[model samples]
Target: MEFTQLLERRRQRWTRFALLFTLFLVFISGLYLVVGEVFISPLEELSALEEQLILQLRLPRLLAALAVGASLAVSGAVLQVLLGNVLAEPGVLGISGGASVLMVLVLFFAPALATPFGFMLAAVIGALAFTILLVFIAKSMCLTTTRLLLVGVALGILSGAVVTWAFYFSDDLSLRQLMYWLMGSIGAASWYHHLLSLILLPVLIWLCCKGSLLDKLMMGEQHAKQLGVDVDQARWQLICAVSILVGGAVALGGVIGFVGLVVPHLLRLALGSENRYLLPISALAGAILVVLADLIARTALDSAELPLGVVTTSIGAPIFIWMLVSHHDSR
Candidate 1:
């Protein structure tokens, strides 16, 4: 790359970063205002309680939401590139289902192991296992995009069946806990969850960004091999990165879906499909969406808080429908 080209790339990246930063600030302000109304005790006491709520309660949830959303979104972007399919995501690829299945198992047989680290570990293992399974199938079958999606759908159904069985066999308390987690919420967000996710997300993002060899692989494995890109190694590394990002988010927030799928696709549509730009931009957009969704989940009703998954799906489904229709019309 020439110096001028590099300068132009840097300028473009900074521009995207600035836009993302502005959106992030707007999201935080909106979340603060919405949460201020819910948690502050009285109108006169608003200022003091707003700070308290932001620091003690809402801030942790917001940070958690940001981490989960960013991780999922970036992971999805990488998956899209790696699989050469716009629809590939942790949720669609059965990674989230894998994590959910593991968590459900823990809730059933080992309720005492329901700590954050335990859940996160289980989620990572489950995600990696399923990812390996998918890779094996892909390689063995010379998988096309459609075939990969079909395989993922099959894995998702299998994981869901396992989860259902666990729920059926569990005690009422365990079942209730599993159900709530599956529905997904930022309600349980705490400093511990925030710190755990914070540690993993940044490192994973760094790894993904550094994997600019991804651009070579995106041209197709045969071409990547010809260009000395170590195709299988790159694929493995990408899978591990995606596993960590998706597994960590699911463990922390309990299977919040669609942000991963929607954010990156939208970013690609707006900014083109380069992973370097797509990764960070989609991360920021995902964080903004999730924080806003959290605000809605908390305050959209009179007394009861709604599940975060419900809010995301409500928003995501329409956007998905629009994308499908638009694609069809374009074709």
Candidate 2:
């Protein structure tokens, strides 16, 4: 049948895209490891100093970039489908805000616990607490989608207020460190952060598998119900999954923006909104973007490093504006 042939062609196209994406990811990852302030040749043997730089300094940072990027992108993709809004992303849910508040508190009151591992733990705890609050409020009040979004906004605002007060009270040294963190950076990343990836990997796989559920939900609640989907349970399942994914990412890399917001939208535009393709490809694309952005952040300035979030926002904001203008023109 002609219909079957059309499906086959579409499948082939996506297969090609996936293959190309994988190759591109590999290339950039290698580039990230080799090209930094001190460039080392991958083809040739390295000095002891080069080996230390690559192993101790760059490798851990590279891994963090990949994990954080992939996690944020997949989280964003799932969120857009769940909220039925193309603009929805992990930050809009207040998960990152919660993580930020806790991280600030640790730095302000308990600087002794402000080590890299300690901050990551604080972030995860804060994100998990906020997620629980959102779930409870949503379940008890029986909130509609718009109402739920407003609740999340309100929570984010509350967290921001608390952080502002902390800023007002903190001394000069803490303030500088806090500002750097708020802007986001993986320059301090260490091998211990790799433990967070154990949490990230399983969640990523689970979310990628939920593409079928997302497709069913896309049609509308009643339609999804007719398709034997339990709408309530699926919604909660997705919320919890997104909470963990976003939490782990924030914990690992601070509040790096735009990766979650822009990566999925770009993929959807290019590949179509089929969650099966969109979810996995978003992960790959997100990893590539973060790795490349980190590369730029470190090497862009000779004396001082750029913030990771600043680099991503600088790159993503323009593309986002163009996307908005293009959508308006199309309409």
Candidate 3:
């Protein structure tokens, strides 16, 4: 009887999550179809330009937002579990910063190789460098959660300084390009950006399935190993996956911040920290959040669009500070 009741409760819990996911899916559809400067009313007839605008511009951009948001959120959740730190994330942990810095260097120094494909490669290389270093240090040094966070932050700061330094030597045109990229726009979103998201889908599935192992790791490395988990292998797999996913996001969206930090954190607070649910739900919620943020970025002002990064940071900063304060209080 108890076992039956437990199964029933699990069913009900999953049902609730399914409903929330559906609602968010509907929200994203609404944003994608109708929520822009020139609304494409589903019920109304459209002109050629209007149809072209939706197909050529808005649709791709919305898809890009969804892809970037989901990738970052999943990466963040995985990192939080892998490191056992609420604050560990792709952006805050220097994955995005690393990508940004290397992409900048490539753009400035190797103009011939600074094409979209080349930049993506550089971003991946940079992201891998930092993520691998962190994973290595954490495993080798047995760093505390707080110490790990500090090291990540220090790496991010160093990356930021390099990105800033690149600005000084760049010409007017390059400066304009760099500034736009740094500000994080979906303005360049295209059908090619879809490729990045498609590559990440299998990776996200793998990470979600590893939730059980992560749960075991929460008990400690020894506990996870004793439970038959290959602790080192799983950890390295997760690190590589995060670097690829986060680097793809940066390559597609240009160093957009805080989606990783905010989405997983917020979902954990609302839905509890069960990785099975948290991982997938965070992906959906992240899609909704970024799509909505992009809508606001486009429609917020009379003549100019806000940077998507700025919108995210404005929301994420306060929540992040609250987490820090609460964490301190608990300690």
Candidate 4:
């Protein structure tokens, strides 16, 4: 009878998960059809101009946004689990900032190599450097997740300084490009850019397979090891996977922040901290949020498109403050 009940519960859980995923997919498809400077309806379409706009432009941009969103959210979920911090996110922890700095340098100093592939490589190197530093500092100082966030902020500040200096010496065109990149815009997305990040979907699957290990790690390093998980190996693999994910994401969509932090935290709050479910669900939710945000960014104003980061940060900042306050009150 106990086994029967357990199986029934598992079936229910899967049903709910499937519904959630399907709802998001529907929203994405619906939004893709109607969002932009022009309105498109899936119900009726027979214009070559509309066909060109939808197929040539909007589809690639939407796909890139989806890929970037999923990558950032899953990376955020993994980092939060690894660090035991709900607030752990690539943008918040300087991973994206580090990548941004490298991208700027490459754009100015090596314009010939400033292709999508080139930027992806540069961003990966930068993200990996920050991730390594983060792991080293956490281990050496034995810092709690909350305190480690301060270190993350310091790294962000350092990256900001570099970006500022780069801006000071750059030309007008360079400055404009840098500003757009830093603020996050998917306006320039193409099929190649989408592929650059979407190709890393396998890495996401590999991370999902490690969900059990991450759940164990949440108990503590010693506890994880006792559970037969290789703590060191898991940590390296998780961080490296995240760096690759973030690198590709930032290369495709620039340094969009808070999707990672907000999506996972919201999921854990609504459901439970089951890493097995949280990671993939968070990926889907993140994709939905980014697509919705992009739609708003493009259509919110008549004269100008808002920065993608601006929309996300505007929405996320309040939730972030609420989380901090909730943490404080709980303490």
TM-score of each: 0.87, 0.87, 0.93, 0.94
lDDT by residue (tens digit), candidate 4, 1-331: 9999976786578559757876976777577757677887768854999898887788888888888888999999999887777888898899999998888889889989888889988998899999889878877888876788889988988998998888887678857776776788988887777668655788877876777778899999988888898989889989889999999998888889999999999888877787877787888888888988888898899899899999999988899889877876776
lDDT string, candidate 2, 220-268, tens digits: 9899999999998998788777777777787777778778879999888
CA deviation > 4 Å runs, candidate 3: 1-11, 139-146, 172-175
Q: Which residue pairs clash within candidate 1?
A: none
The local distance difference test score of each candidate is: 0.77, 0.82, 0.81, 0.85
Query: Best TM-score goes to which candidate?
Result: 4
In candidate 1, how many clashes are counted? 0
Score residue 181 of candidate 2 by CA lDDT. Answer: 64
Q: Assess candidate 4 and give its TM-score to the true structure.
A: 0.94
Question: Distance (Å) between predicted and true CA of 66, model 3?
Answer: 0.6
Quick one: ranking by TM-score, best first?
4, 3, 2, 1
lDDT of 1 by residue, 305-325 (tens): 889888988888788667756
Better of 1 and 4 by lDDT: 4
After superposition on all CA atoms, what RMSD does each candidate show versus the true structure? 3.3, 3.3, 2.0, 1.9
Which residue pairs in candidate 3 have backbone atoms (N, alpha carbon, C) closer than 3 angstroms, thus clashing? Answer: none
Residue ranges of candidate 1 with Cα displaced over 4 Å = 1-17, 20-23, 26-30, 33-50, 321-331
The C-alpha stretches of model 2 lying farther than 4 A from their native spots are 106-122, 128-158, 172-175, 324-331
RMSD of 4: 1.9
Best by lDDT: 4
